[model samples]
Target: MVLSAVLLFGASSVTSLNGVFAQDSVDEISESVGDTVDNAASDISDAVTDEESESTTQEHGEMVHDDEGRLPGNIKIEREPTYKVGDDVQINATHMPGMEGAEGTVIAAFDTTAYEISYTPTDDSEPIENHRWIVQEEIAEAADQEDADAPFEVGDEVTVEAYHMPGMEGATATIDAVNETTVYLVDYIDTESGEEVINHKWVTEDELATLDGAEETAPATSESTTESSEDESESEESSSDEESGSESDSTPEENSDEESSEESTPEESSSQDSSSEETE
Candidate 1:
C-alpha cells in the first residue's frame, strides 16, 4: 500500500509539471501575436507620417506668407529686384519671406504673356544665377507701364509663367515694389563677418542699404558740379559787367579830352583874332 501511494504522488506531480509547461507555451504564443500586432500598427503609423510629409512637399502653390512682410530666418538677404527684363508693374507681394519690400527690375512686359527667364545666381561660393523670378504675367503690361511712367514701385505683385525654378515659373510671386533706376549686375563680397558666403545672392535696387554712402556720395558730387556750374555762370556775368563799366568809364575820359581840345582850339583862334585887332 505505501509503495502504491508513493507512486501515485509522483505521477500526480509529473502531470502538474507538464500542465504548467503547456500553459507557458500558450502564453508565449499569445505574447508573440500581440507583438506582431504592435509592429504592424507602428509600421502603419510610419507610413502615414511619410505620406503626410510628401503631401506637404507637393504643395508648390502654397506660400509661406508673413502679413507684415517680415522675412524669415532662412532668408539670408533681401533687396528690390530690378526689372531688367519686364515692363513696369505694381509690387503686390514678397518672395522668400522678408522680401515684400524687395525691389524687382522689370526686364520685359507682356500683354497677357508672362515674362520668365532662368538665371543662376553666382552666390554662396556657388555660381547660382539659376534664380529666375517672373517679372510680369497674366496682366496687361501696357496698362501697368502706363500707370508707372517712372519705375517699379512697392505693393505690386506678379505671377510667373516661365520655368526658372522647379515650379517658380507660372507660380505667382508678388511685386514687392517697382523701382526705376540704374540696376547693377555686380560682384561683391558680403559684409557679414564670417558667413563664408563668397558670392551671396540678392537683387538690389538704387535705394537699399547704402554701403559707405555710395548713392548719397553720387548726389553730393552732383551738387558740387551744379555749384561749380553756377559759379562759372556768375563769373561770366561779373566779367561782362566789369567790361561794360570799363568801357563806360574809358569813354567819358576820351570824350572830356576831346571837348577840352575843341575848347582850346576855339580860344586860340579867338586870341589870334584879338592880337590882329590890337595890331590894326
Candidate 2:
C-alpha cells in the first residue's frame, strides 16, 4: 500500500509539471505572435509615413519653383509691342498653376528671342520640360560669345544663366523650341487662390489673347451721343410745351377783350339811334 501511494503521488506531480510546461509554451507562442504582429504594423506605418513625407516634400518643392516671382535684371525691352503696358490680356500658358486661362495685364514687353528648354534640375528633382522664355541673354555661353545675336537651335545644349526658379541657374539645358516673338511680363490674380501675382515674367505672344470684345470706343461714344441727343430732344419738347401753354393762356384773354369791345360798340349804336329819334 505504501508503494502504490508513492507511485500515485509521483504520477500526479509529473502531470502537473507537464501541464505547467504546456501552458508556458502556449504563453511563449502567444507572446511571440503578438510581438511579430506589432513589428509588422510598425513597419507598415513607417513605410506609409515615409511615402507621405516624400510626396509632401516633392509637392512643396514644386510649389516653390512655381511661386518664384523675382524679375530678371537687365532684360531687353520691346519697342512698339503689339500688346502695350496696361493692356488686358488672357493667358494660355500652363507653366504655373492657375496661369492657364487667367486674365492678366501686360506690365512689360521684351523683343528678345525666347527659347523653350528642357533641363534636369540641379537639386536632383524631376526634369523640367519645355520651359518657356529663356532669352539669348539668359544663356551663359551665348551671352559670353561675341555673337549674342545668334539664337540657339532646337536640341542644342546650353548652360542657363537665368534663375527663374531654384536649381535653374548654372544648370545645363537643351533648347526645345525658339521664337522671335514678343515676351511679356504680366500681373494677374490667381484663379484658384485669388492672390495677386505681380511682375510674372515671360509669357509669349502666342500664349496671350486680347481681351474678348475689347474695342476702341466707337460704340461707347455713339451710345453717349445718342443719350445726349435724346436728352436734348426731351428738353426742347418740355420748353415748347411751356411756351405753347403760355401762348394758349394769353390768347383766351385777348378773345375776352375783343368780345367786350364789340359789346361796347353795340351799346354806342343804340344810343345814337335813341338820340336821332328824340331829334325827329
Candidate 3:
C-alpha cells in the first residue's frame, strides 16, 4: 500500500509540471503574435504617410518647355497627323503651370529632332533636370569649324543657343533623349492668370486633341503679332512727331537772337558816326 501511494504522488507531480510548462509556452506565443501585429500596423502607417508626402511635394515645382518661336530644320513629316497646323486643339500636357486643359491654337507643325536636356536657368534658379523639347536648331555647336547640322546622341554635352527658358540661352546641357516626331507650336490662354500666350513653341503632336469640327482658328501669323507690329509703328510715329516739334520750337528762339544781333550792330555804327561829327 505504501509503494502504490508513493507512485501515485510522483505521477501527480509530473502532470502538474507538464501543465505549467504548456501554459507558459501558450502565453509566450500569444505575446509574440501581438508584437508582430503591432509592428505590421506601424509599418503600414509609415508607408501611407510617405506616399502622401511624396504626392504633396510634387505640386511645388514646375516643368517648363521651350516657348520660343518655332524654327524649322530640314525635317519632313513621315505620317499624317490627327491635327494639322491652324487647327484649334485642347492641350492636355501640363509641362508648364496653367497649361493643362487649356485651349490651344496650333501655329506650326513639323517633323524634327526633339531633345530632353538638363540645364541651369540664366536667372540663377535651381538647376532644372530632364527639361523637355530643346530642338536641334536650339543647340549651339561646340566648335565653329564643326558642322552645325551634326546630330547629337544621348550624353553629348553641348551649349544651348535657345532662349526658350531663362538662363537657357548660354548654359551647357547634356542630352537625355532624342525623338523624331511632329512638333507643334501653339498659342494658349493661361488658365491661372487669364492671360493670352501667343506663338508658344514646341508642344508635340501627342499633347494636343482636336475639337469637333475644328476650323483654322490659328493664323499663319498670329493676330497678337499683328497688333504688336501696329503698336510699334504708332510708337515710332509718335517719336518722330515729338522730334519734329522740338525742332520747330527751337527755330523761333534762333530767329529772335539773330534779329537782336542785327539791330545792335546798327546802333553801334550810328553811335560811332555821332562821336566823329562832334569831334569835327
Candidate 4:
C-alpha cells in the first residue's frame, strides 16, 4: 500500500510540471506574436507618414530651389531685353506648378539658347518631360562644343550641368526643343503656395507678357469696355424713349386745344344769330 501511494504521488507531480511547461510555452508564443504585430504596425505607420510627406511637398510647389541650387557660372547677359529688369510681367511657363500665369518681376536677363529636355532623374524618379529653359551653358557637351550658337538638335543626348531640380545634375538628358532668345531671371509669388520665389532662372522672352497685356487682363478689360458700351447704348435708348414720350404727349395736348376751339366757334355763332333776331 505504501509503495502504491508513493508511485501515485510521483505521477501527479510529473503531470503538474508538464502543465506548467505547456502554459509557459503558450505565454512565450503569445508574447512573440504580439511583438511581431507591433513591429508590423510601426513599419506601416512609417511608410504612410513618408508617403504623406512626399505628397505635401509636391502639393506646396516645393520643387524649385532658386539660387541655392547649381547655376551656370558664366552665362552671357542680354544687354537689351524686350522685358527689362524691374519690369512686372506675366509668366507663361509651365516648368513648375503655379509658374504659368503667375505675375513676376524681372530680376535679370540673358541672351542664350534655351533648351527643353527630357530626362530620367538620378534618384530613380519618374522621367521628366519637356523641362524648359536649360541654357546652352548648362549643358556640359554643348558648353565644350566649338559653336556656342549652334544648339543641340531634338533627340540629341547630352549631359546636364544644371541643378534646377533634385537629381537633374549629371543626368543624361535628350534635347526636345531649342529656342534662341532672351531668358530672364524673375521673382514671383507661387500661385499654388502664395509664397514668394526669388531669383528663379530662365524664363524665355516669348514666355513672358506685360502685366497689362496678360491674356486674363485683356479679357477683363474687354469685358469692362463692352459693359461700358452696353451702358451707353441703354442710356441712348432711354433718352430716345423719353423724347418719343414727350412728342406723343404734346400731340394729345394739341388735339384737345383744337377740339375746344371748334366747340367755342359753334356757341359764338348761335349767340350772334340770337342777338340779330332780338334786334329784328
At residue 133, give the lDDT of candidate 3.
Answer: 77
> For candidate 1, lDDT tens digit of each residue in 1-280?
9999999999999999999999999999999999999999999999999998887544321322112322112221214333334322223233333333333334322221112233222222222222323233222232357542223334344443333224443343444434323322222222222111111122334223333434557889999999999999999999999999999999989999999999899889999999999999
Model 3 lDDT on a 0 to 1 scale: 0.76
Off by over 4 Å in 4: 1-62, 213-280
Q: TM-score of every model?
A: 0.32, 0.57, 0.47, 0.57
Number of clashes in model 1? 51
lDDT score, candidate 1 = 0.44
Worst 10 residues of 1 by lDDT: 192-201
Query: Per-residue lDDT tens digits of candidate 3, residues 1-280?
Result: 9999999999999999999999999999999999999999999999999988776444332223334554644445535666766778988877677788889787767666678888777778789888777777777663352765456899988888776556778898999988766777788887876766777766777778876445444553478789999999999999999999999999999999999999899899999999999999
List ranges where model 1 is wrong by over 4 Å: 1-94, 97-161, 167-212, 237-241, 264-280
Instruction: Name the TM-score of candidate 3.
Output: 0.47
List, residue by residue over 1-280, the lDDT tens digit for candidate 2: 9999999999999999999999999999999999999999999999999999999766644443445455555567888998999999888988777788889899888878889899987889799888876887788887666777678799999999887666888889999999988888888877766777777767899999887756655688999999999999999999999999999999989999999998899889999999999999
Question: Better model by TM-score, 1 or 3?
Answer: 3
Q: What is the per-residue lDDT of model 4 for residues 125-198, given as tens digits with 9 covering 90 to 100?
A: 88988987689898888757788667889899999988767788999999999898988889998888788887
Q: Please name the candidate that would achieve the greatest lDDT relative to the true structure.
A: 4
Query: Which residue pairs overlap in candidate 4's backbone?
Result: none
